[model samples]
Target: MTDATSRDGTRSGSTAQPVGGAKGPDELRRQIEQTRGELGDTVEELAGKADVKGRAKARAADLKDRAGAMTVHLRGSAGHTVRGGAGRADPPSRRARHAVRAGLGHPRAVLVAGAAAGVAVAASLARRHRHGPC
Candidate 1:
Protein backbone atom coordinates (compact mmCIF):
# COMPACT_ATOMS: atom_id res chain seq x y z
CA MET A 1 0.00 0.00 0.00
CA THR A 2 0.62 3.25 -1.30
CA ASP A 3 -2.41 5.37 -2.24
CA ALA A 4 -1.47 4.87 -5.94
CA THR A 5 -1.82 1.12 -5.73
CA SER A 6 -5.11 -0.59 -6.66
CA ARG A 7 -6.77 -3.27 -4.56
CA ASP A 8 -5.33 -5.86 -6.95
CA GLY A 9 -1.81 -4.31 -6.48
CA THR A 10 -1.58 -2.58 -9.84
CA ARG A 11 0.28 0.75 -9.80
CA SER A 12 -1.08 3.85 -11.61
CA GLY A 13 2.35 4.65 -13.09
CA SER A 14 2.34 1.25 -14.88
CA THR A 15 -0.25 2.54 -17.43
CA ALA A 16 -0.16 6.35 -17.22
CA GLN A 17 2.13 9.04 -18.65
CA PRO A 18 2.16 12.85 -18.27
CA VAL A 19 0.38 14.65 -21.13
CA GLY A 20 2.74 16.98 -23.10
CA GLY A 21 1.87 19.89 -25.49
CA ALA A 22 -1.81 19.82 -24.44
CA LYS A 23 -3.89 23.00 -24.76
CA GLY A 24 -5.90 24.25 -21.77
CA PRO A 25 -9.36 25.85 -22.08
CA ASP A 26 -7.98 29.43 -22.29
CA GLU A 27 -5.47 28.50 -25.05
CA LEU A 28 -8.18 26.72 -27.06
CA ARG A 29 -10.45 29.81 -26.76
CA ARG A 30 -7.65 32.08 -28.02
CA GLN A 31 -6.99 29.79 -31.03
CA ILE A 32 -10.69 29.79 -31.90
CA GLU A 33 -10.82 33.62 -31.72
CA GLN A 34 -7.76 33.91 -34.00
CA THR A 35 -9.29 31.54 -36.57
CA ARG A 36 -12.56 33.52 -36.52
CA GLY A 37 -10.69 36.79 -37.14
CA GLU A 38 -8.87 35.25 -40.15
CA LEU A 39 -12.18 33.95 -41.53
CA GLY A 40 -13.75 37.41 -41.20
CA ASP A 41 -10.87 38.97 -43.13
CA THR A 42 -11.20 36.39 -45.90
CA VAL A 43 -14.96 37.08 -46.15
CA GLU A 44 -14.30 40.84 -46.44
CA GLU A 45 -11.76 40.24 -49.23
CA LEU A 46 -14.22 38.12 -51.17
CA ALA A 47 -17.03 40.61 -50.70
CA GLY A 48 -14.88 43.36 -52.14
CA LYS A 49 -14.63 41.50 -55.47
CA ALA A 50 -18.16 40.04 -55.60
CA ASP A 51 -19.75 42.72 -57.93
CA VAL A 52 -23.15 42.50 -56.24
CA LYS A 53 -24.62 45.48 -58.13
CA GLY A 54 -23.61 44.05 -61.49
CA ARG A 55 -25.16 40.70 -60.64
CA ALA A 56 -28.41 42.40 -59.61
CA LYS A 57 -28.53 44.33 -62.90
CA ALA A 58 -28.01 41.14 -64.86
CA ARG A 59 -30.80 39.42 -62.94
CA ALA A 60 -33.16 42.33 -63.62
CA ALA A 61 -32.41 42.16 -67.34
CA ASP A 62 -33.05 38.41 -67.37
CA LEU A 63 -36.42 38.89 -65.66
CA LYS A 64 -37.33 41.62 -68.15
CA ASP A 65 -36.56 39.32 -71.06
CA ARG A 66 -38.66 36.54 -69.57
CA ALA A 67 -41.57 38.94 -69.06
CA GLY A 68 -41.30 40.09 -72.68
CA ALA A 69 -41.29 36.50 -73.85
CA MET A 70 -44.36 35.77 -71.71
CA THR A 71 -46.21 38.73 -73.22
CA VAL A 72 -45.40 37.55 -76.74
CA HIS A 73 -46.46 34.03 -75.91
CA LEU A 74 -49.81 35.20 -74.47
CA ARG A 75 -50.48 37.36 -77.53
CA GLY A 76 -49.74 34.48 -79.86
CA SER A 77 -51.96 32.13 -77.85
CA ALA A 78 -54.88 34.59 -77.93
CA GLY A 79 -54.42 35.14 -81.61
CA HIS A 80 -54.41 31.42 -82.28
CA THR A 81 -57.65 30.84 -80.31
CA VAL A 82 -59.34 33.70 -82.08
CA ARG A 83 -58.25 32.44 -85.49
CA GLY A 84 -59.31 28.88 -84.64
CA GLY A 85 -62.80 30.07 -83.64
CA ALA A 86 -63.06 32.12 -86.82
CA GLY A 87 -62.00 29.16 -88.96
CA ARG A 88 -64.64 26.97 -87.26
CA ALA A 89 -67.33 29.59 -87.88
CA ASP A 90 -66.52 29.89 -91.56
CA PRO A 91 -65.88 26.91 -93.80
CA PRO A 92 -62.89 26.75 -96.13
CA SER A 93 -63.03 28.12 -99.70
CA ARG A 94 -64.51 25.92 -102.44
CA ARG A 95 -61.07 25.56 -104.08
CA ALA A 96 -59.49 24.49 -100.78
CA ARG A 97 -62.39 22.10 -100.13
CA HIS A 98 -62.04 20.55 -103.52
CA ALA A 99 -58.31 20.16 -103.07
CA VAL A 100 -58.75 18.48 -99.69
CA ARG A 101 -61.49 16.22 -101.10
CA ALA A 102 -59.30 15.29 -104.01
CA GLY A 103 -56.45 14.44 -101.64
CA LEU A 104 -58.75 12.43 -99.36
CA GLY A 105 -60.14 10.54 -102.42
CA HIS A 106 -56.71 8.88 -102.77
CA PRO A 107 -56.19 6.19 -100.07
CA ARG A 108 -52.40 6.76 -99.67
CA ALA A 109 -52.75 10.56 -99.64
CA VAL A 110 -55.58 10.36 -97.12
CA LEU A 111 -53.47 8.18 -94.80
CA VAL A 112 -50.50 10.56 -95.07
CA ALA A 113 -52.67 13.64 -94.39
CA GLY A 114 -54.41 11.97 -91.45
CA ALA A 115 -51.10 10.99 -89.91
CA ALA A 116 -49.74 14.52 -90.35
CA ALA A 117 -52.85 16.07 -88.77
CA GLY A 118 -52.69 13.61 -85.86
CA VAL A 119 -49.02 14.42 -85.22
CA ALA A 120 -49.72 18.17 -85.35
CA VAL A 121 -52.64 17.94 -82.94
CA ALA A 122 -50.62 15.73 -80.57
CA ALA A 123 -47.72 18.20 -80.58
CA SER A 124 -50.04 21.15 -79.93
CA LEU A 125 -51.73 19.38 -77.00
CA ALA A 126 -48.40 18.32 -75.57
CA ARG A 127 -47.13 21.93 -75.63
CA ARG A 128 -50.35 23.20 -74.05
CA HIS A 129 -50.20 20.59 -71.30
CA ARG A 130 -46.54 21.22 -70.59
CA HIS A 131 -47.02 24.99 -70.24
CA GLY A 132 -50.23 24.76 -68.12
CA PRO A 133 -53.19 27.20 -68.36
CA CYS A 134 -51.89 28.96 -71.43
Candidate 2:
Protein backbone atom coordinates (compact mmCIF):
# COMPACT_ATOMS: atom_id res chain seq x y z
CA MET A 1 0.00 0.00 0.00
CA THR A 2 3.01 2.24 0.02
CA ASP A 3 3.75 4.58 -2.85
CA ALA A 4 7.21 4.58 -4.35
CA THR A 5 8.90 7.91 -3.74
CA SER A 6 11.96 9.38 -5.33
CA ARG A 7 14.99 10.81 -3.52
CA ASP A 8 13.16 14.18 -3.38
CA GLY A 9 10.44 12.49 -1.19
CA THR A 10 7.58 13.03 -3.69
CA ARG A 11 5.72 10.01 -4.99
CA SER A 12 7.62 8.86 -8.02
CA GLY A 13 5.29 5.78 -8.18
CA SER A 14 7.85 3.72 -10.07
CA THR A 15 9.57 0.62 -8.86
CA ALA A 16 13.26 0.74 -8.01
CA GLN A 17 15.37 0.19 -11.05
CA PRO A 18 18.98 1.05 -11.74
CA VAL A 19 19.26 4.40 -13.51
CA GLY A 20 21.21 3.24 -16.52
CA GLY A 21 24.29 5.17 -17.58
CA ALA A 22 22.56 6.24 -20.84
CA LYS A 23 18.79 5.81 -20.94
CA GLY A 24 16.82 7.86 -23.53
CA PRO A 25 14.14 10.48 -22.72
CA ASP A 26 11.49 8.49 -24.57
CA GLU A 27 12.28 5.42 -22.47
CA LEU A 28 11.99 7.49 -19.30
CA ARG A 29 8.73 8.98 -20.50
CA ARG A 30 7.32 5.50 -21.11
CA GLN A 31 8.42 4.39 -17.66
CA ILE A 32 6.79 7.42 -16.09
CA GLU A 33 3.56 6.76 -17.96
CA GLN A 34 3.60 3.13 -16.83
CA THR A 35 4.17 4.19 -13.24
CA ARG A 36 1.31 6.67 -13.42
CA GLY A 37 -1.03 4.02 -14.76
CA GLU A 38 -0.08 1.59 -12.00
CA LEU A 39 -0.53 4.28 -9.36
CA GLY A 40 -3.96 5.17 -10.72
CA ASP A 41 -5.05 1.53 -10.57
CA THR A 42 -3.80 1.16 -7.01
CA VAL A 43 -5.61 4.31 -5.89
CA GLU A 44 -8.80 3.13 -7.54
CA GLU A 45 -8.55 -0.21 -5.71
CA LEU A 46 -8.06 1.51 -2.37
CA ALA A 47 -10.94 3.90 -2.99
CA GLY A 48 -13.20 1.04 -3.99
CA LYS A 49 -12.42 -0.72 -0.73
CA ALA A 50 -13.19 2.40 1.36
CA ASP A 51 -16.53 2.97 -0.42
CA VAL A 52 -18.95 0.61 1.36
CA LYS A 53 -21.98 1.38 -0.77
CA GLY A 54 -19.89 1.26 -3.92
CA ARG A 55 -18.41 -2.10 -2.91
CA ALA A 56 -21.89 -3.47 -2.15
CA LYS A 57 -23.19 -2.20 -5.47
CA ALA A 58 -20.24 -3.69 -7.29
CA ARG A 59 -20.67 -7.04 -5.54
CA ALA A 60 -24.39 -7.05 -6.24
CA ALA A 61 -23.73 -6.24 -9.89
CA ASP A 62 -21.20 -9.04 -10.09
CA LEU A 63 -23.63 -11.48 -8.50
CA LYS A 64 -26.36 -10.37 -10.86
CA ASP A 65 -24.08 -10.93 -13.82
CA ARG A 66 -23.19 -14.39 -12.57
CA ALA A 67 -26.86 -15.20 -12.04
CA GLY A 68 -27.69 -14.09 -15.58
CA ALA A 69 -24.91 -16.22 -16.96
CA MET A 70 -26.07 -19.20 -14.91
CA THR A 71 -29.61 -18.71 -16.10
CA VAL A 72 -28.46 -18.73 -19.70
CA HIS A 73 -26.39 -21.83 -19.15
CA LEU A 74 -29.23 -23.60 -17.33
CA ARG A 75 -31.68 -22.74 -20.08
CA GLY A 76 -29.33 -24.08 -22.71
CA SER A 77 -28.80 -27.28 -20.76
CA ALA A 78 -32.25 -27.83 -19.24
CA GLY A 79 -34.10 -26.79 -22.38
CA HIS A 80 -37.35 -24.87 -23.02
CA THR A 81 -38.78 -25.44 -19.55
CA VAL A 82 -36.53 -22.63 -18.32
CA ARG A 83 -38.78 -19.95 -19.86
CA GLY A 84 -42.23 -21.51 -20.26
CA GLY A 85 -41.82 -21.99 -23.98
CA ALA A 86 -44.39 -23.68 -26.24
CA GLY A 87 -43.26 -27.09 -25.03
CA ARG A 88 -40.51 -28.68 -22.98
CA ALA A 89 -37.52 -29.54 -25.10
CA ASP A 90 -36.29 -31.88 -22.41
CA PRO A 91 -39.14 -32.72 -20.12
CA PRO A 92 -38.43 -34.27 -16.74
CA SER A 93 -38.85 -38.00 -16.52
CA ARG A 94 -42.12 -39.27 -15.01
CA ARG A 95 -40.44 -40.69 -11.91
CA ALA A 96 -38.56 -37.45 -11.31
CA ARG A 97 -41.73 -35.42 -11.79
CA HIS A 98 -43.56 -37.68 -9.40
CA ALA A 99 -40.85 -37.31 -6.80
CA VAL A 100 -41.05 -33.55 -7.14
CA ARG A 101 -44.80 -33.66 -6.84
CA ALA A 102 -44.46 -35.69 -3.66
CA GLY A 103 -42.16 -33.01 -2.33
CA LEU A 104 -44.95 -30.43 -2.46
CA GLY A 105 -45.72 -29.12 1.05
CA HIS A 106 -43.00 -31.40 2.35
CA PRO A 107 -42.33 -30.93 6.04
CA ARG A 108 -38.64 -31.79 5.63
CA ALA A 109 -38.02 -28.91 3.26
CA VAL A 110 -39.78 -26.49 5.62
CA LEU A 111 -37.88 -27.77 8.63
CA VAL A 112 -34.49 -27.57 6.87
CA ALA A 113 -35.05 -24.03 5.54
CA GLY A 114 -36.38 -22.87 8.91
CA ALA A 115 -33.47 -24.40 10.79
CA ALA A 116 -30.97 -22.77 8.38
CA ALA A 117 -32.58 -19.39 8.86
CA GLY A 118 -32.46 -19.81 12.62
CA VAL A 119 -28.78 -20.74 12.54
CA ALA A 120 -27.98 -17.81 10.28
CA VAL A 121 -29.79 -15.38 12.58
CA ALA A 122 -28.03 -16.74 15.64
CA ALA A 123 -24.63 -16.44 13.98
CA SER A 124 -25.42 -12.89 12.87
CA LEU A 125 -26.43 -11.91 16.39
CA ALA A 126 -23.25 -13.42 17.80
CA ARG A 127 -21.12 -11.56 15.25
CA ARG A 128 -22.92 -8.28 15.99
CA HIS A 129 -22.37 -8.66 19.71
CA ARG A 130 -18.68 -9.37 19.11
CA HIS A 131 -17.98 -6.69 16.51
CA GLY A 132 -20.58 -4.09 17.54
CA PRO A 133 -22.11 -2.73 14.29
CA CYS A 134 -20.58 -3.71 10.93
Candidate 3:
Protein backbone atom coordinates (compact mmCIF):
# COMPACT_ATOMS: atom_id res chain seq x y z
CA MET A 1 0.00 0.00 0.00
CA THR A 2 3.11 2.27 0.23
CA ASP A 3 4.55 4.23 -2.71
CA ALA A 4 7.32 1.65 -3.04
CA THR A 5 5.04 -1.40 -2.88
CA SER A 6 1.58 -2.72 -3.71
CA ARG A 7 -0.67 -5.43 -2.26
CA ASP A 8 1.60 -7.96 -4.03
CA GLY A 9 4.61 -6.74 -1.91
CA THR A 10 6.47 -5.81 -5.10
CA ARG A 11 8.40 -2.52 -5.49
CA SER A 12 9.30 -1.83 -9.13
CA GLY A 13 9.74 -5.64 -9.43
CA SER A 14 13.30 -5.04 -8.22
CA THR A 15 13.33 -7.40 -5.26
CA ALA A 16 11.13 -8.68 -2.47
CA GLN A 17 13.19 -6.78 0.08
CA PRO A 18 13.15 -3.24 -1.24
CA VAL A 19 15.73 -0.77 0.11
CA GLY A 20 17.00 -3.55 2.39
CA GLY A 21 13.43 -3.67 3.77
CA ALA A 22 13.65 -0.16 5.21
CA LYS A 23 10.21 1.32 5.83
CA GLY A 24 10.50 4.85 4.36
CA PRO A 25 10.21 6.77 1.11
CA ASP A 26 13.81 8.01 1.52
CA GLU A 27 15.14 4.42 1.73
CA LEU A 28 13.23 3.50 -1.43
CA ARG A 29 14.68 6.50 -3.28
CA ARG A 30 18.17 5.56 -2.14
CA GLN A 31 17.72 2.02 -3.41
CA ILE A 32 16.49 3.27 -6.77
CA GLU A 33 19.44 5.62 -7.08
CA GLN A 34 21.86 2.79 -6.21
CA THR A 35 20.27 0.56 -8.83
CA ARG A 36 20.52 3.31 -11.42
CA GLY A 37 24.19 3.85 -10.65
CA GLU A 38 24.92 0.12 -10.94
CA LEU A 39 23.01 -0.14 -14.22
CA GLY A 40 24.90 2.84 -15.64
CA ASP A 41 28.24 1.24 -14.78
CA THR A 42 27.20 -2.04 -16.40
CA VAL A 43 25.99 -0.24 -19.53
CA GLU A 44 29.28 1.66 -19.84
CA GLU A 45 31.31 -1.52 -19.46
CA LEU A 46 29.20 -3.33 -22.07
CA ALA A 47 29.44 -0.43 -24.46
CA GLY A 48 33.23 -0.39 -24.14
CA LYS A 49 33.38 -4.10 -24.92
CA ALA A 50 31.01 -3.74 -27.85
CA ASP A 51 32.99 -0.88 -29.46
CA VAL A 52 35.07 -2.45 -32.26
CA LYS A 53 37.49 0.46 -32.63
CA GLY A 54 38.00 0.64 -28.87
CA ARG A 55 38.69 -3.08 -28.68
CA ALA A 56 41.14 -2.90 -31.58
CA LYS A 57 42.95 0.02 -29.94
CA ALA A 58 43.19 -1.94 -26.69
CA ARG A 59 44.52 -4.99 -28.54
CA ALA A 60 47.05 -2.92 -30.45
CA ALA A 61 48.25 -1.26 -27.23
CA ASP A 62 48.68 -4.67 -25.60
CA LEU A 63 50.64 -6.01 -28.57
CA LYS A 64 52.84 -2.91 -28.65
CA ASP A 65 53.60 -3.31 -24.94
CA ARG A 66 54.50 -6.97 -25.47
CA ALA A 67 56.73 -6.09 -28.40
CA GLY A 68 58.50 -3.42 -26.32
CA ALA A 69 59.08 -5.97 -23.52
CA MET A 70 60.49 -8.48 -26.00
CA THR A 71 62.77 -5.83 -27.43
CA VAL A 72 64.07 -5.04 -23.95
CA HIS A 73 64.75 -8.71 -23.27
CA LEU A 74 66.54 -9.15 -26.57
CA ARG A 75 68.59 -6.00 -26.06
CA GLY A 76 69.66 -7.17 -22.60
CA SER A 77 70.70 -10.57 -23.92
CA ALA A 78 72.59 -9.11 -26.87
CA GLY A 79 73.83 -5.91 -25.28
CA HIS A 80 77.49 -6.83 -25.27
CA THR A 81 77.54 -7.89 -28.94
CA VAL A 82 75.11 -5.31 -30.23
CA ARG A 83 76.36 -2.34 -28.21
CA GLY A 84 80.10 -3.17 -28.25
CA GLY A 85 81.36 -2.71 -24.70
CA ALA A 86 84.21 -0.28 -24.10
CA GLY A 87 87.73 -1.61 -24.85
CA ARG A 88 86.19 -5.01 -25.70
CA ALA A 89 84.27 -4.08 -28.81
CA ASP A 90 83.01 -7.04 -30.82
CA PRO A 91 84.46 -7.30 -34.34
CA PRO A 92 82.43 -6.70 -37.47
CA SER A 93 82.46 -10.43 -38.28
CA ARG A 94 81.03 -11.25 -34.86
CA ARG A 95 78.42 -8.53 -35.21
CA ALA A 96 77.49 -9.82 -38.66
CA ARG A 97 77.18 -13.34 -37.23
CA HIS A 98 74.75 -12.08 -34.59
CA ALA A 99 72.70 -10.24 -37.21
CA VAL A 100 72.57 -13.34 -39.37
CA ARG A 101 71.42 -15.49 -36.46
CA ALA A 102 68.67 -13.01 -35.67
CA GLY A 103 67.42 -12.96 -39.26
CA LEU A 104 67.61 -16.74 -39.70
CA GLY A 105 64.61 -17.19 -37.40
CA HIS A 106 62.31 -16.19 -40.32
CA PRO A 107 64.22 -16.87 -43.52
CA ARG A 108 61.36 -16.22 -45.94
CA ALA A 109 60.40 -12.91 -44.37
CA VAL A 110 64.05 -11.94 -44.16
CA LEU A 111 64.51 -12.64 -47.89
CA VAL A 112 61.44 -10.65 -48.80
CA ALA A 113 62.49 -7.74 -46.60
CA GLY A 114 65.99 -7.78 -48.03
CA ALA A 115 64.65 -7.82 -51.61
CA ALA A 116 62.35 -4.89 -50.81
CA ALA A 117 65.22 -2.94 -49.24
CA GLY A 118 67.40 -3.65 -52.28
CA VAL A 119 64.72 -2.40 -54.63
CA ALA A 120 64.23 0.74 -52.54
CA VAL A 121 67.95 1.47 -52.53
CA ALA A 122 68.21 0.89 -56.30
CA ALA A 123 65.27 3.18 -56.95
CA SER A 124 66.72 5.92 -54.76
CA LEU A 125 70.11 5.70 -56.49
CA ALA A 126 68.50 5.81 -59.93
CA ARG A 127 66.50 8.85 -58.91
CA ARG A 128 69.57 10.60 -57.62
CA HIS A 129 71.41 9.85 -60.87
CA ARG A 130 68.54 11.15 -62.96
CA HIS A 131 67.93 14.30 -60.91
CA GLY A 132 71.46 14.97 -59.63
CA PRO A 133 72.31 15.22 -55.91
CA CYS A 134 69.67 16.70 -53.69
Report backbone clashes per prediction: 0, 0, 0
lDDT of 1 by residue, 16-44 (tens): 32233127888767767987999999998
| Residue-level lDDT tens digits of model 3 in 6-124 | 66565665356643486689987988899899999999999998899989999999999999999999888787665566547779999999989989898998999999999999999
| Model 1, residue 41: C-alpha shift (Å) | 19
Q: Kindly state the number of residue pairs that clash in model 1.
A: 0
Which candidate leads in TM-score?
A: 3
Q: What clash count does candidate 3 reach?
A: 0
Clashing pairs in 2: none
lDDT comparison, 1 vs 2, better candidate: 2
- Measured against the true structure, the TM-scores of the candidates, in listed sequence, are 0.30, 0.33, 0.47
User: Candidate 3's C-alpha lDDT?
Assistant: 0.84
All candidates in order of lDDT, best leading: 3, 2, 1
The TM-score of candidate 2 is 0.33
lDDT of 1: 0.78
Computed on alpha carbons, the lDDT of every model, listed in order, comes to 0.78, 0.79, 0.84
Model 1 scores worst on lDDT over the 10 consecutive residues at: 13-22
Question: Against the true structure, whose lDDT is highest?
Answer: 3
Which ranges of candidate 1 are over 4 A from the true structure? 1-49, 87-134
